[model samples]
Target: MTYRTSLTALALTLAGLVAHPSPAVALSSVQWKSCPAYSDEVIRSLRVTEEQVPAFRTLMKRLECGTVSVPLNHRDPGGRKIDIAVTRLAATDGSRRLGAIAVLPGGPGNSGYLDPILRSALRNKEMAGLNERYDIIGFDPRGVGYSTKAACPLSPMGPQEPGTMTKETARKIYDSQVATNQKCGRSDPAFLGQLTTANVAKDLDLVRAALGERTLNLLGFSWGTYLGMVYRSEFPEHTGRAFLDSVAPPWTRLDRHTKDAAAAAERNFGRMATWLARRDELYGLGATARQVREEVARLVGAYDKSPKTFAGLQRPIDGSAVADLAKLNSTEWVRAGKALAELRTTTGTTAPPTVKELLGAPMMGTPVPGAPETLNMTMNLAVACNEDAGRTGFDTAWRAHQRLVTRHPATGRGWGLGVRCAGWPLPVQETTLRRGGGSLVLAGHLHEFMSVYDWTLQTRRAVGGTVYTIADDVHVSATRVPECAADVVRYFDTGRIGSGCAGVALPS
Candidate 1:
């Protein structure tokens, strides 16, 4: 999900995690060993050429890979236990060493064991400099890959395209998901119930104890940002400076968060419309923001009534597809406008082009540098359902979905109906983040989608911290940016935030 890399190796202490092991399970220290095959995608993202692969491989060969045993429930450390997979890259210069920095990734299920690649993948020497001063740590949380996996049948239904989910369709989907929740959640209630964010934070403290370190700094993103906050809250005395990029809201009401995200998406759509309006002479969509929005809505409605066939595509060009594009990442704003313009022509009077000719090429991808990350949808459901306390039933859910769809046309139709937790097996452990740790640096983007920008400000307000506003929409991208990476390294080396620096750039 994130990345890191590096040099001299350290011997595994192989000693007891605590002065003595728990009666139920003996905790082992992280044992450094031979690393697994590096992710092809991660290597590709780093632009690690054939010539560079050999050296890169040699560099990563020094990577420490193993696991640490932690209790399944921190409340009962003497109860059943689970293994937490881990990876570490020792600092190149131990003499000037600061301490360890854990790379906490986004997906509650995102595998982090191979993330040490960002040190070499990123464009600046900042990571290299940061590496010299620290030991980078990566771990797959319990119930994720390499760690004890949380298994269950995935929900039969998922969020659908905008304009396609009618009240009837929503009800059917909700019932199916509720059924999945009961069945899957019942599979392993004891272990699955322990997979909350709070438990992960407890596991991090265990990792710190195993490392024999008094404090551990955090380098987290998206979901990881929330994880860092929780860790800091749980173990403030052990938590050091944290760099949380693309921060999540400190609050835990999943429904409210979902509503805010849908609103943010519509707001971003407006921003894209403004951009297209300025270039109306070229696209012929509209001369102003409001006109462009109306034209897009009309185009979507027409396609909804009757979709047009297109070769080489999996599905026809329909209202659902139209809405998705209209609110895609900013990088795709140009193509989205042209595609809608082409649809507008045909629906209104006569015509459009073979998709590519109208919409142009697909947008660039933002892949993580690790083995292809998978969403243990099983883990996703368990975590989401357990984390969300609102537990919205179908009645309230339908009403909320209708309100969102009617109020926010651009993204509301596609937003989740928010009823999955209604029949969840585990009791909700709503966590209210309590600030206690060292200095924290929060980074946010202006045109974000999944983890909206507002959450950043909300998080800062929740827990006092310095904030950095990124102009681009890419999630968790600060370390990938040259200036932002420097700022991040500076913060870790000496707690200081960046000025109004540039973020990921949009296409020219």
Candidate 2:
């Protein structure tokens, strides 16, 4: 599944001042286990069902994907089996075959199995050096697409509608999420319980053996960075080189990440306002960036005071609304500006365009609404729940809200960390995130809205590797910066890290 950094984690690493790589070796603790071997055809057949074979076969040529069956519980070597989906793009140049570079996509829920196809979106140019030498591989972790999925099936119906969630709604959505987790948890509590990073890293090692590789080079983004770090710690011997982009510190708890994301949203508002001011003619918000920011703040406040009618739904255009919008499409600065301008003019003034019209739902001109939540929420919650086990409950969350609102009035509740898992069903499987063995490279943004910088530092210390700081507002640098990409690619090509990077500052 695709994962992203919490806003808190993003903010702390914005300065782009994190650190460089270190010459570290992979961990030797993990012994390579014997994997049941399968032919290419057999491997391809494993990820699909009898009925899906036709489509799977057709798509395989386009994407060249395959699947492998693993025991549901690793400890119980002989047990009910689950499938792990994999896709690979072989080295275009056979003479340069470097091995395999595994990509761990963010979103504990985002499908990485299809990443080879999506590589054009964020694959580093520096990766070209290893293009012919190594195969780029993406996998769908358990409970995600094409893999043995854990069903928390959500209906397409809207929240206020029969199957969707609404402000007043509860059981339908709650049960869906809870029931999904319970079913997956019950399937093989031993393995499901063991779904921690440490074990997942072990799973990677097995995948490496299955593919007949000596070491695995990795490129991880956001939450994927943590997985890379964990794998580095658990099975350093398997490490070849790793590039961790938009890093989230290992020590960061769910509560802290959420809080920091809210704060970053506030900062984003200012940046967005400035962007809007530059194009005032299209959106007559203000003459200056600061002026435009005030107007935007006023618009958000007005929407909060009274829900606005948009896209046939009475939309509560509050902080959550703003955050969701940002997460859905932060890259399109101009389109978002236009939408904000229109929102200001139409809110409370008239029944604005349908939510679809307002959000440019058709996907031609603008992004589809709820895209971020649809792709991000499940995995975000999973990671948060797993990492922050000691904390739970509405009161605990409400108190956090109290602190956030006091500090950030403009974008507090809406931008603040949400407790969607307050009533989560299954207990978390892991808590502490430690770094050991291998030389891992963790990257962070100085002022990211989702993850905090401090968390990156904690993670760096835990992993004993350098953290690269971006010193910018952009979320994950792996996809955004060529320099960062070069740094990552260099690490993967050889076990060398740039000396320019540094460790997180210690607390006074």
Candidate 3:
């Protein structure tokens, strides 16, 4: 799914999150079990269906495909079974195969099944070099994408009617959100317990065994960094090369996350405002950058009364949503700016489509980690409640938010003191995720409000790796920045971690 941008307030608010509990010591020896027994004619069964057989054949022509069944519980050799799905785009130069490279996507929930195809489109010389020698492997992790998945009905967290929830109303809504998460936990007792980094790392091991590889190379992003870290710690012998971009450290606190995101997003929004103003001729929102800021402020203020409606649906165009839209690279900004300006400038008598209606389809296959179409509140609450060890309450969140909003009004009101994930019911996982290894590269840009540099810094510390600070103002570096991209492709291809990589320097 397309990733969601971090709200500026989320960055600031989340910055305070303390390091998670010290993780359990890595497990030695995964009690290996034979693949789940299935009909030997499983392939034959697929082939028996005329249309399905041809589709499988077409898939095989492009890539080698396979399924490896794993124990639902790694601790129990004999337990309920789940199959992990894997696909590979083999090295084109058949004779010069280096080994297997696993693409670890972000979200702690996003799938990596399409990275091989996505990387193929890059056509960079360095990426081409890796393509020539390595079979890029993409797999959907347990509860994500095409893997053994989990679903919660939308009835619990459905969208509100426009003007139904003000900031005060949102707090009340969050009470039910907390209950919904607690209920989801009760609904799916088994899967919820098994979603930790350690379990996922072990899942990687099963995939490694199935692929018949002694060592596996990893490429991880966002939350995927922790997955790789855990994998490395548990099976150092199985580790090969690893490259992490937009790193999420194992020890970030909610408070620290909130602070960093808020500060960074405030700046990113300003940058976005400038970019928007530059094309004022098209968007016509403002004649200059300062004017653009005024225009954006006007939009936010206007939305407070009633969100702008695009089509028939309501739009929760909150601060984070706005910050997310700003983080798009320059190319996307122009089109987004035009749309945003028109939406903001239009009168209430005429409305644009709600964000939900405009983006009717699921957001998939893009750099943003969370699925924009999925219920945001659900995922935010689920993951945060699961990951947050913080013991603070909604009242605490509200008080803190008031302080921030009072200070930075324009961006603050949207994020300032919002009680989205503060009311989670489950106890946070108390594991500090540091994986010691050699030559891991942590990369992130300055202004990724969602996956901020703090995450990168924390991940670098945890993995005993170096940080590659991008000289750009956007987030999701590997896909956006050129120099950072080159360094990543080089590291993956040759396992070279550059030394003394510097942050963006001020001009002389």
TM-score of each: 0.86, 0.71, 0.74
User: Tens digits of per-residue lDDT for model 3 on 171-227?
Assistant: 766676566554565445355555556666777887887777888888887777767
Q: 1-508 in candidate 2: lDDT tens per residue? A: 1114343543332222111122232322222222223334543333334554554444345455566666545554455666676667677777867778888877666667656534422243454444556788777776665566544333233433321123334434444544454443333333334344544565677677667778888888777887887777666778877777777666535666677677776776676666667778877988797887677666555655655544444454554454344332245555566666666666354434433344534322232332211143344444455455545454565566667755654466453324554444345555344555556776776656766666777776666777667665566655435665566666666767664332222111
Better of 2 and 3 by TM-score: 3
**lDDT of each candidate versus the true structure:** 0.74, 0.56, 0.59
lDDT of 1 by residue, 1-508 (tens): 0011111110111112112212333445876556777665566655666566666676677788888888876656776778888888888889999998998977777777666655422335676667778888888888887888766865445434434567888888788878777777666666777777887888888888888788999999888899999888878899999988888988777788878888888888898888889989877878999988887777767776777665544346666677777767776776777777666665432235535554333433445755444445666677777788688889899999889878876556555678867677556666767878999888888888778888888898888888888888777778877888888888899888764467877665
Overall local distance difference test of candidate 2: 0.56
Who wins the lDDT comparison?
1
Root-mean-square deviation per candidate? 8.5, 11.2, 9.5
Which is the leading candidate under TM-score?
1
Between prediction 1 and prediction 3, the one with superior TM-score is 1
Better of 1 and 2 by TM-score: 1
Q: How many backbone clashes does every candidate have? A: 7, 68, 45
Report the backbone clash tally of model 1: 7
- Runs in model 1 lying further than 4 Å from the true structure: 1-27, 38-56, 119-124, 158-163, 345-373
Sort by lDDT, best first: what order?
1, 3, 2
